[model samples]
Target: MAQLEYADGIWSGIDEAGVARLEIDRPEVLNALDGAASARIIDLCGAWARERGVRVVVISGRGGAFCAGADVAGMATDAAAKGGFDESDSRAIIENGSRLVGAVRALPMPVIAAIDGPAVGIGASLAVAADLLYASARSYFLLTFVRIGLMPDGAATATFAASLGRARANSMALLGEKLCATEAFEVGLINGVIEEPEGLDAVVARAAAKLCASSPEALALTKAALDAATLTQYEAAIDREIAGQTRLLQTPEFQAAIAAFSAGSR
Candidate 1:
């Protein structure tokens, strides 16, 4: 009820300017999102969609990093308890990630991602789903799933491919390269990138304010039409990810990586 109560390392609030802000607040893990956090995100987006006063939505993370991706540490625990990552609960996390991206896309108003630092895996996917993406000098987009023995989920395969095309997306998903803010801006992956650190909010605010000044009907219609034109294959990609990631999570490769990560982090 009412966009689901805040908890689970996420924060949501609407400002007087009709801007709804969603902040990922788990800085200790660099804002790694778990299943519960993603669920709350989906609920918050649904609630914002219904609020007439909400004109724009802004998503960002607290601390230096925007989001480090899925809670790999949590995944490690889940895998340990379940004897593997192939369990129903682990698969649920993958499906929830797809739903999270869908929720961001479903928002009627323009959404801006103020990426202040690293956005990896689903975190990168989430940022790319925004209508406007801004980044700080310290920020980078990385599809690190390859390193963890998984492919990009959360519609990253679609959104990144749609935004930067196959070759660039492949560079990230295939090689797990870090696309820095300057490079992202140069390649047109982001709307703007601040050369100075901590100035990302200003850029995002300006973009959100401009959208707020525009006719709500016009902005919403434009976003919908653009989605229709550009994201024609998005839904199919989500389905593909859910199926593929469910299987991949069960693989020995992923299991070994999770084990190694857990040991190394300790």
Candidate 2:
């Protein structure tokens, strides 16, 4: 079987059983969500969302870490070159990130985030956006937006609270706490955590199998209805997040923080 692969960033392939696998391919950078990665992921997800025979979708990372966060290095470089901020680019950035995350949340069939390691910042947003999230014991979830002087994009503020309650989500966002897999499971951020490395795939595959057996139409409808109110609220929250992110991208604090991350000083 051919493995999923992509040129710029996101990669995709269907399993023999028709499960679509979408991977963030930049292992060198911890599979960070750069502009390229975000675009590719959104496109692939949109395709899968509309395609037939793709009963399930699985997202994971190429490296051990599922995703550490957005590409701070790339963001910093772009920000600095534009004299600290380019509104046009910032709009694209926010739109791409939020849309991709929203796509995952709205995907008709089951979308599973098979997390094996750190899922921080927007990474955590992606995981929480999924209908089901499975993480390895070694995995940890973090929302490091406030730590870097940026507010949440990717509809994270809404999704996080929906999955893990307001208090825990607030702490994760505001305090930048790292919620271990066990803690995440307990708080309902993740559906479950596996201990063995192979167990991660097994658990995800089993869940996909179960989802695949169900009526796709019924599953899709149920998912939509269950998530309707929250997603409705998120529509507005996402717009606010984009506006805040755009403004923050222009601030000295975000620039310095990105610089530190890029220079390996984080």
Give the winner by lDDT. Answer: 1
Give the runs in model 2 whose Cα sits over 4 Å from its true position.
Answer: 1-3
lDDT of 2 by residue, 1-266 (tens): 32776757877898777799987878878988887778788788888888888888999986788998888887767765776666777677778788878778768888899999899888888888888999999999888888888987788988888877888878888888889999888877789999866789889889999998899899888888888865667888898999999888767887788778767833
lDDT of 1 by residue, 1-266 (tens): 01423588888888888999999999889999988888889999999999999999999998888899999998898788888854576578788898898899999999999999899889999999999998998899999998988999989988999989899989989999889999999998998889876677778888888988999999999999999999899989988988888888888999999999999989
What is the lDDT for 12 in model 1?
A: 88
Task: Please give the CA lDDT of all the candidate structures.
Answer: 0.89, 0.83
Return the top candidate by TM-score: 1
TM-score of candidate 2 relative to the true fold: 0.94
Q: What is the total number of backbone clashes in candidate 2?
A: 0
* Residue pairs with backbone overlap in model 1: none
Backbone collision count in every prediction?
A: 0, 0
TM-score of 1: 0.96
Query: lDDT of model 2 at residue 70?
Result: 87
